[model samples]
Target chain A: MPVLYGSYRSRATRNLWLAGEIGLELELRQVWQAYRLDKPDAPDAPFNTRSRGFLSLSPMGAIPVLVDGDLVLAESLAINLYLARRYGGDLGPRDEAENALMTQWTLFAATAMEGPGLAIQNVHTYGRADSEAGRGEIADKVEALGRPLRVLEGHLGRDGHMVGGRFTVADINVAEILRYAQSHEPLLAEYPAVDGWLRACQARPAFRAMWDRRAAEPMWL
Target chain B: MPVLYGSYRSRATRNLWLAGEIGLELELRQVWQAYRLDKPDAPDAPFNTRSRGFLSLSPMGAIPVLVDGDLVLAESLAINLYLARRYGGDLGPRDEAENALMTQWTLFAATAMEGPGLAIQNVHTYGRADSEAGRGEIADKVEALGRPLRVLEGHLGRDGHMVGGRFTVADINVAEILRYAQSHEPLLAEYPAVDGWLRACQARPAFRAMWDRRAAEPMWL
Candidate 1:
């Protein structure tokens, strides 16, 4: 059994989705904490430096860490890839070329999509929309994100899925990041293939269950 | 033969090093364009909205994309992994756990090390050291890098190498990023294991050959 540490509404949402897809018995450990940037000693501090388990799992004190006995893993993308590879099913690709493609898209999501997606999150979820600095940052990010989205649109324009013709962990990881773009940008009308692929990803029963679970959780930002 | 686009001194350095390690021939294509942050007409510019090849290789208009016939791969880390896996001898690990560890560290180098490492590079190589903003940014980044450096110190403290206790693509990926750190921050005396591991990586014959080749090339940026 693997124990996943983080909240449902967090990046842990993807990990939960992965667990569901792999049918792994996962114990969800919710660390109730709040992150006050100014107050360093707040008891409910999110990513509390005092939590030994979190610190042990992730020295940087971040979320979405998976602890499988002694083999602890952090970094959500790495966790998803590890789960897919270990479970040994269709979660990843069988062919070498396809595997390379899977990695390409996964890295793309992390490097290209994440920056703007984080900026969008900072604006909408954290209520930073009013500040001139915040608006400038968001505008810069939005411009930065367009080209990558177009590239994704072009790739999906040919194939229904990202790596293989079928759904894989690559799709799951990329789609999870795209959700941030979809929520904040809502300009999917310009990219038909991306919209179609995202819809296809959402149609998964496992994804729906995870989304519902996330919707029921209290918002934290 | 694989065609690698970008200069040897750029991010493509790792791929070139991996190619040397695996005895693979990579056709190097030099895109001799200055990186203009906000300009529109720089030749071979990555973010130039007009460069089709740049867009095709990297949607974000970044460099060092690998093209193996029709299959194009971007993201230096992913490209290195693909090369190592395809032309396997010692480039890849022998077992599943080692392979996972390899992937974990490769991803860590991309996400954890690259940002601050680039900041350090900008300060030392491009951004004038005397400029207040450049110095301040470098100081901030060096401080930010301490946590990841400690993590690397912890890992190397236990094992001599990054993965499998021997050299692999993980070391190549991480070593390249750490080389930037070494060049920029001479105050790296506190982390002994990291320093030792970096020296070990640089001591490789192939690495030495690549470093010499890079030294002969004219500086860009």
Candidate 2:
């Protein structure tokens, strides 16, 4: 059995969605869920990100650690990629070429989309998106995001999926980043294709199930 | 022969270093190089990041595209991973678990280290590292960088390589990130292990070769 360690509050939500898509049951260990009620700051509590046991598992001690037998892996993208490759039925790439594309989209999601997406989220979450200074900063990020979004728009506008005209890990990876843009209502206005593609991708039953489950998680704060 | 589109000016350097490490010859497409000498404003040229052909290769028009047979990948990390896996010989992972670690560290490098490392570079390139606001910003980035750097330090302190107790694609992915910090002298001071590990990794003939080749490339503006 493979164990995924992280809270949905973190980037672990992406993996949870992936597990849903692949119909795989993961033994989830939520550090935050445990921390909410348990002795989070206690020296021996395994729920703490800084716990000795966690450190032994990963040098980063960051959640979304997956311990599959002898392999203890951290980082959500890696875990998702592993799960897709190892257990994904149609979700995994068919060959080395497809594998390269999968890696490309995954890295793009990680590097380009997620970074600006997080900034927009941060600005919105902090109530700064409405201010003049915040708007300026938001404009810059949006402008920076424009290039990638345009790419997505042009591609998704013509094609249905990210690769091979089907739902794969690439769709999950890229769409998840766009989902973060929901708070910024106007951000998606320019990228109609991306917006439409995101809706279609999220319309999948697996995504619905994951969202429901995520909504059901108890918030610590 | 596989075509790796992009110059050392882009993330392609990472893949070139891997090619050097594994003794693989890649068709290096120096688009930006030709831009400086040939037609700087060619509309259909593949050299232009915004050209129609380059956009056809990549939606985002980002560089370091790897065209291996039928596969066209745009991200540098993805290209490096594919190269290592497909043609790596001893440089690739040995098993499924090792593959997971390779993905993990590669994502870690792509997501964690590159962002701040680029910011640090921007500060240095603009000669802002010495200003008050610049110092404050530098302090913030360095502090934010502390977590991942410390993670690298603790792990490198114990293990010489990132995985399997030997050199693999994971080491190349990570060591490249730390190399950016070389410009920041005091940054590596606290993490003596990471410093030593980086020095040892960079001392490899392959890395030296890549650096020499990069030094020889013509800069365009």
* Candidate closest to the true structure, highest lDDT: 2
Error of 1 at A212 (Å): 2.1
Tens-digit per-residue lDDT, A1-221, candidate 1: 78888788677888889888878778988853436234435555555434665677666566677787667777778788878877738987787777788787888888778867877877877778678887787778777788788888888887778887888999999999888866555557788999889998899899999999989876643
Clashing pairs in 1: A34-A44, A34-A46
Q: Which stretches of candidate 2 lie above 4 Å from their native place?
A: A33-46, B33-46
Judge the docking of candidate 2 as incorrect, acceptable, medium or high: high
Query: How well is each residue in B104-196 modelled by candidate 1, as lDDT tens digits?
Result: 777777777777887788787774777998878878878877888898899888888888788899899999987776656554788999988
Evaluated on CA atoms against the true complex, candidate 1 attains a DockQ of: 0.53
Where is model 2 chain A poorest over a 10-residue stretch in terms of lDDT? A32-41
**Predicted structure with the largest DockQ when compared to the true one:** 2
Candidate 2 structure quality by residue, lDDT tens digits, A1-221? 78987787777887889998888989887676344545766765546576666667776867888888888888887887788889987788888888778888888877877887888888887899889988887788788787778777888889878877888888988888767766678888887888888888889898888788788877664
lDDT of each: 0.77, 0.80
